[model samples]
Target: MTRLNHQEKAKEFDKWISWKQEGNKDAETELIMRFLPLVTKVANRLAIGLPATVDKEDLISFGRFGLLDALQKFDHTRGLQFETYAMWRIRGAMIDGLRENDWIPRTVRDKAKKIEEAYTRLEQEKLRTPTDAEVCEYLGMTEKELQQVLYDTSLAAMVSIDEAVGEEDEQKTARHSYIVDEMTPRPESVAEAKSLKEVLSKCIDKLPEKERLVVSLFYFEELTLSEIADVMNLSPSRISQLHSKAIFRLRSALTRWKSQLL
Candidate 1:
């Protein structure tokens, strides 16, 4: 998609409104073209850490199919917003394609699993979050090796977040849409959003110091890993490892909470 000025964006939005409300067949091509930006955005994000052999266009193609599927199957009358749902579907589709392609090696996934196991076992044994030194010792790995493993598994953590988590025979809620309230009678209620956010806030508070800071800087402050490394005076590789560990803990917490709801 070409870079659009404010007026151009407004015009496109107007076209979308017409296509949505009036069912204008003439605007359908424009509609598909407009979706390219969304696909491109997700493709770029997921392209990180991928091997050079993996073409960016392939990821975009996967996301394009997701967008097409989303457009076809989406219930316009359900009143649920489309963009958020479609984002998850697009990411999920790209990850699905990557998995089928074996883009992430099995060894990396096994290493990540072992690290998580070490976290759980050490926590159960000591009744607290395990220190990095302790986790390294438990895994019989050097600090550098642990960092490499964490970095390798970071993409897996990302794939986990891309899951579509609903139980319907068809479309389900997007897992990465963050928190959707199952407890509330009204899923769209503002209080429902707040409650789920509070749960995540509490989980963040429970993280160890360095991991917590890494998440804060990366998510809240929107800093890249290299920028975070500069601010923290650590290597970018180390920051990537911390980011991976932080996401792993978050994913575990959210999954457990979701299971309880189920």
Candidate 2:
């Protein structure tokens, strides 16, 4: 199948809008068929890292409603492209659907909002992308507290590109339409990382009950050594020693497993 350029798609969209305005049934079908892939694309982008129970098809269905709304409200003579307007509508619809379905928890959403605000403030103050330390300082959070916030925020956040702001021409075009580069670190590297994580999990499981608890609190729960020590009723130095020993065991196991795989 031949791919339509943005201009061609915009022209077709205008025709669909006219047909729908005239109450033509066939035009509605044509419009849906032409833009279904676009709906799916936006849905996929919004649903990244979401659970399997949230069906992609459901998001597309919701996006169709948004497309219909956009078609009805579109003013072609105003010099704005339909695709550009419809993209936001479609994305908003999908996100609204997820929100209605309770896919995001209130706590997670709050954290994401806080992180976004903190980032915005830091960017304004620094006039550049600030380091993680800068963010921690601005938020008045210790490193461990900051990491927990980041992890929670990531759990609920949707991946989106930077939208073109304040530029009519750029706003009318797809901001990130080009294919992303796929030549990242090798598969072997990813495999190695996965192997290391698995080995570390196993090593942690083998620790004495107190040590296991300490590791879980420090890594998975993002707690500080002092916090873990208080929870386990041990000295902070003892918790530190246990953490170092656990890491050493994990590294040794991973090294052995890697040699076998080779």
What is the TM-score of each predicted model, taking all chains together? 0.76, 0.47
Query: Stretches of candidate 2 above 4 Å error?
Result: 1-18, 49-54, 76-80, 117-130, 133-148, 155-262
How far residue 234's Cα lies from its native spot in candidate 2, in Å, is: 36
For 1-262, candidate 1 gives per-residue lDDT tens digits of 4566889767766676677778887776777776668888778656544445679899998999888877666665565555655666787789888899897898878887888778767766887777889999999999888887888887776676556544463645444454333332245544544555676777778898888887787656646655778889997767767777876776666655666666
Q: Scored by CA lDDT, what does every candidate get? A: 0.71, 0.57
Note the clash tally of each candidate.
0, 0
lDDT score of residue 107 within candidate 2: 82
| Candidate 2 clashing pairs, residues 3+ apart or interchain | none
What TM-score does prediction 2 earn? 0.47
